[model samples]
Target: MPSKTSIFLTGATGAVLTRLLNHPSSNTFDITVLVRNADKANILRTKFGIKTVVGTHQELDKVESLAEGAHVVINLAEADNVPFMKAILSGLRKRQAKLGDPPLLIHTSGTGLLADDARGEYITDVIYDDLNVEQYKSIPDTAVHRNVDLLVINADIEGYARTYIIPPSTIYGIAKHALVDAGVSNPHSIQIPVIIEASLARKHAGVVGKGKSFWPDVHIDDIADLYVVLYDTIVANPENVGHGWEGLFFGENGEHSWYQISKAIGEAMVTLGICTGPEPTPFTKEETEKYFGSEQWGWYSSILPREPGACLGMEADVHH
Candidate 1:
């Protein structure tokens, strides 16, 4: 029999979090949305008949208190840098110290921690079932991945919490109604950066380098599903699944080369009346800069091969 678990999600209304809420797994587990607005949280209760707890991003302790003896705490809140995540881990520690059993913690993170994509190191295809945890932790010390992973392990040592990380390659899924500042419109979201790369491909973008570095990616829904799957997988098979661990599911449906991306952008530019179709690839990063803007193209994100599966087979009712 599976244990009835309650999960507290920090970024409850995010593109990925939205998919998790509507997933079938949500039916089995008791979910509590942790957001900054009490009114907004209450809306989820009225709409989905689900419970939402209003809480701040930096202070997860109050949310922890609301969680009380929850089965899981899923955090996707990373404000500023790594401090927010470090704070969540700290909150769990306080919970176990004060309360009896701190919940199992699930963190939404990226694989860049394993290798610095900016440094041109990309490692893919190997499964966590085969690799050693401590070894991958050594890849990029600068990668907040190492710090976050350590926090989970530390919590486990104190018997405060069991931590799991669901690392997304590059996610491009249906952006939620409220998920603004993402996708092709903003170009900062993982979806546009990894899968679409519209700003970079249009010759409107520049490479953070020679424009050849690449990274793996997945669709946001598949990424969201993994969290739900992780919770259920553990609930049904604690005998088999380890609590203190990580799952690296790149969820790449298709691998596209950098050249292909540049070509696609060229075609789009001509179609959108931004540039002539025959215009040479990146004739000048400045020319294309009009569209993506210099600030948006600060990091040359256009060149990487999109990790496959931006759109899983399922119909995306959630708008892009």
Candidate 2:
């Protein structure tokens, strides 16, 4: 019989990771998750039968210790937490030096890194495919998600863990996880929920500018399946591992316009008697901040477009 893979997972409560935890293959591993809340920890332990370590991402020492023993470290938490990432990498590097083999580090990112920042009025024709090495290389260092992803890839090249970045597009749909039996489901996707909340509060639905900007989209289940596929491929064939698969792996199945999404939300609200009209309106920067708060204004209201060519194309094996 094959030895069980030891998996250290963060963000077990997130949308993608929640589905991953419920995947059939998840039972094949010895899983330990780091969660910040006591209630969530109890739920994960009771519902999924996974071990838990109580700590936040800011707790570097705890994160490092948990990562050191695992053969695979899957991080689905905040991509912008550079210090936490450094801690995880530091632990993996130490383990590599001692064991003479690197662990697999799967980090979550998003296709927003490819966003053109059109802020809703403009559209770009450039799309980046994961197989297109040149386009991947051309991603600007200043891109929203570039720094941490580059950090992980560079660590892989330095003989730490064999790292792969999964940059999924805006994820939708409810996650199908065992935690749902415990009456817990991962929250709805970020963009749409905020729009819904603001619409209910203000008595209308709104978008940014002309709302023509596009973002790639994928279902929560599909994103979880891709993670499992990548994991199985790597574990089954160690010889397939190298720097070649170190960078971005996108999870987009399709794309949608902000205007169309807003219109749908408006129609839903009207049908439900939450608002008076099915016609959507546009919100200015100040108005957006007033409704969604200043921090979330840009994220919920901007026009972020990914070029059509940037589709992931869903390869079963990462090497291909």
Which 10 consecutive positions of candidate 2 have the poorest summed lDDT?
Answer: 308-317
Candidate 1 per-residue C-alpha lDDT over 143-184 given as tens digits, one digit per residue, 9 for 90 to 100: 435566566666776677777665555565455443333221
Q: Tell me the tens digit of each residue's lDDT in model 2 across 1-320.
A: 23777889887765545655655776777889898888878887886787988888889998988888888999877676789888999889888887887888988876767766566776666757787777777878987667787888888878777888888776778765556546545545555666667767778988777777777778877887887778777877866743434456788787777777788999999999888888878775676667655524344332222211121111111222
User: All candidates' lDDT scores?
Assistant: 0.50, 0.71
Question: Can you list the residue pairs that collide in candidate 1?
Answer: 169-217, 170-217, 170-218, 204-288, 208-300, 252-308, 253-308, 253-309, 254-308, 254-309
Model 2, residue 153: displacement in angstroms?
A: 0.5
Residue 197, model 1: lDDT of 53
Residue pairs with backbone atoms closer than 3 Å in model 2 (clashes): 126-307, 127-307, 127-310, 128-310
Mark the 10 consecutive residues where model 1 has the least summed lDDT.
311-320
Return the lDDT, model 2, position 279: 82
TM-score, predicted candidate 2 vs. hidden true structure:
0.87
